[model samples]
Target: MSLSSFGFLIEEASRNVRRNGLMSAASITTVAVAMAVLGSAVFLLHRVQQFMDAQPRQFEIAAFVTMETSRSKAAQLKAKVQRIPGVYRVSLVPREAALRQMMDEDHKAGTRITDALVGANPLPDRLDVQLSDPKATRRVAAILRDKDKFPAIEHVRDDRETLDKLLATTRLIRNVGMAVALLLFLATAFVIQNTIRLTIFARRREIRVMQLVGASSGFIRMPLVIEGVFCGLAGSIIACGLVLLVIRQVSQFAGRLQTPFAFTMPAAMSPSVIVGLLLAAGAAMGWVSSTLSIRRYLRRV
Candidate 1:
């Protein structure tokens, strides 16, 4: 279309919104509420996935050395474990150090259970192993357990069960969020579609007059479609603002937590990306809803 024609379409679309101010405001508000709910779910799922991905990097494997193993032999085993593929780092924790740590923890908790041991440090020397890929945790633990290859080690332990539970929980959260988000998306679209249809209905007489004056269906539909897009965009901006405010408040609350429950914001859930996603979703919903609504009405006319 030419500049003049495009300007006319924009003007007409603007006029339509102004003429139906109440309905337009209602449409914008409905869209904002729907988008906000859907956006929160999507954002939460993204953060959970990010947390799950980072978990493996923090997981550790522990290999306990037998009481008969000499300090020199334990050091050799640590060096050997470090040389293994996928092993990121290995540090030796002597039984004495372990005993001290355990006692310190017990004291902090107001429990003196270790006081009964009285110079009998039953804690064994262990190798704390970090892995480049946590998927190899079991394999590396098995290697450390092999008696013929590493006779100094008596027990192999890892956070495999904890990791499994964590992964399963995140997966469940992600799947449920996705399902809910999908439903909300459809609901949002439906609301926009119905709202746009109402706007078209209110302007049916004007549309008929335009057609009688030799206006093509496209000429009549373009302005309404643009109006729908405007409404969608307006709603999305509001939704994004609300979502950011909530996220900021949530982050503040999380920071105040004094336990392991405290967490950092996921890098993937950046504000820029969130804003862009909501804007795109809003614009697309408006365009699709208006196009479909106008097309169906034009056919019946």
Candidate 2:
């Protein structure tokens, strides 16, 4: 379209908004509210996924050796375990270290359990193994249990259950997030469509007059479509700002918690890219709603 045509479309869209000011405001407000909720959910899901990805690295495999294992044999076993596929690092914890750890735990628990009172330190030397993939921990544990490899092996411990729980929770959150987002999107579309319907109804005579004057449907519809797009763009901007404010407040609150919370801002995409996506979503909703409302009126006229 020429610049003049574009200018006329803009002028007509502006006139439509001014003529139905209250309905326009309502439409923008509804879009903003729904978009804000959906945006916040998306941001939260992204942050949670990031946090989960970062936490899996902290899971470790504890390979406990039999009490009768010699120090030299334990060292050899530790080296062998480190060579296993997916194993990242292995640190040997001597029996003395284990005793010290147990004593520390006892102190924390307010229980006075001393090595002398226990007659001997029953703690055995073990290897603390870090794995590249937390999912492969079960296999790694099985390998350590091989009698021929390390006969003195006693037990293996890893946060496999905890990791499983976390994964399941994340998946649940993702499913719920998608469902909520879809519902909010449909609600927003309905609200916008109804709002446009009202606006079109108020201008029923004007649309009929344009049709009578040999105005093509495209000429009549272009301006209204532009108006819907403007409403969507305005609403998206408001929604983005509101979402940022809510995220900031949530981050501050999370920071004040006694236990550390892995709260990070959603991944930073280019500002242009984010704005483009929001604008596109808003525009698409607006255009579809406007088209439906206009079609309904045209059929009657």
Candidate 3:
């Protein structure tokens, strides 16, 4: 199309939006609401994934040695485990350190359980191993459990079941979020299509007149398509703004409630890319709705 033709299409679209002010507003609002929900879901899924990713690395696998094991043998066992594949760090937690940790916890809980009261420190000296991969915990544990490999080692303790449950929950949430977002997106599209159809219905007479005067189908369709694009663009912008506001408000509310979870909004992208996506989505939705609406009317016309 020529520049003048494009200009005419834009001008006609603006006029249509203004003439059907209520319908335009409804379409924009629907688009905005739908986009906002989808954006929020996307942001939440990303944040949850980050949290889950951090969990496994933080998990500590404790390799407890036999109570009668010699200090030299314990050090040798620690060195051997440290050399194993996937072992990120290996530190020996002496019996005294284990006792100290328990004492600290008891003190924090306002309990005074002295060593004399407990008869003796029953805590075992352990090799505290941090893995580079949380998913390798089981394999790492198995390696540590080999009596021939680490004869001094008595048991291996890790929160394997809890970590598995957490990962499973994360996957479930991701799947559910995607399913809901897709359903909402389709619903939004349908609503916008119907809204555009209503606008086209109101202009059916004008379209018929143009067609009778030998106006090309392209010429007749261009303005409505542009109008749809405008609606989508406007809706996306409004939705983005609303989502930002909601995130800010939620963060503030969480702080007041002393909630452990904090909202982390996505970083702003380059203005050009951000604008492009929003406008493109809006325009595409608008075009699709307009095309369908016009096609149905054209059959009767």
- Whole-model Cα lDDT of every candidate shown, in order: 0.85, 0.79, 0.77
Error of 1 at 2 (Å): 4.2
Best by TM-score: 1
Clashes of 2: 0
- What is the lDDT, from 0 to 100, of the residue 174 in candidate 3? 90
Please write out the lDDT profile of model 2 over residues 55-107, one tens digit for every residue.
54666788898888899999988888889999988999998988887787668
RMSD of 1: 4.2
Model 3's alpha-carbon lDDT is 0.77
Number of clashing residue pairs in every model?
0, 0, 4
- All candidates: TM-score: 0.79, 0.73, 0.72
Query: What does candidate 1's lDDT look like per residue over 1-301, in tens digits?
Result: 7899999999999988998899889989988988888888888787788888777666788899999998999998899999999899999999999999889877976899999999998999989998999889889888888899888888888888778887899899999999988988888788778877887888888888988898877888899889889988999999999888877876787556544322354565788999999999999999999898877765434
- After superposition, the stretches of candidate 1 with alpha carbons farther than 4 Å from their true spots are 65-75, 82-126, 131-136, 146-148, 256-268
Please give the lDDT score at residue 180 for candidate 2.
98
Error of 2 at 236 (Å): 1.0
Q: What are the runs in model 2 whose C-alpha is more than 4 Å off?
A: 53-58, 64-79, 82-135, 145-148, 151-155, 253-276, 295-297
- Residue-wise lDDT of candidate 3 within 125-214, one digit each (tens)? 899898998878999999999998888889999878877886799889998998988887787777767766776787788788888898
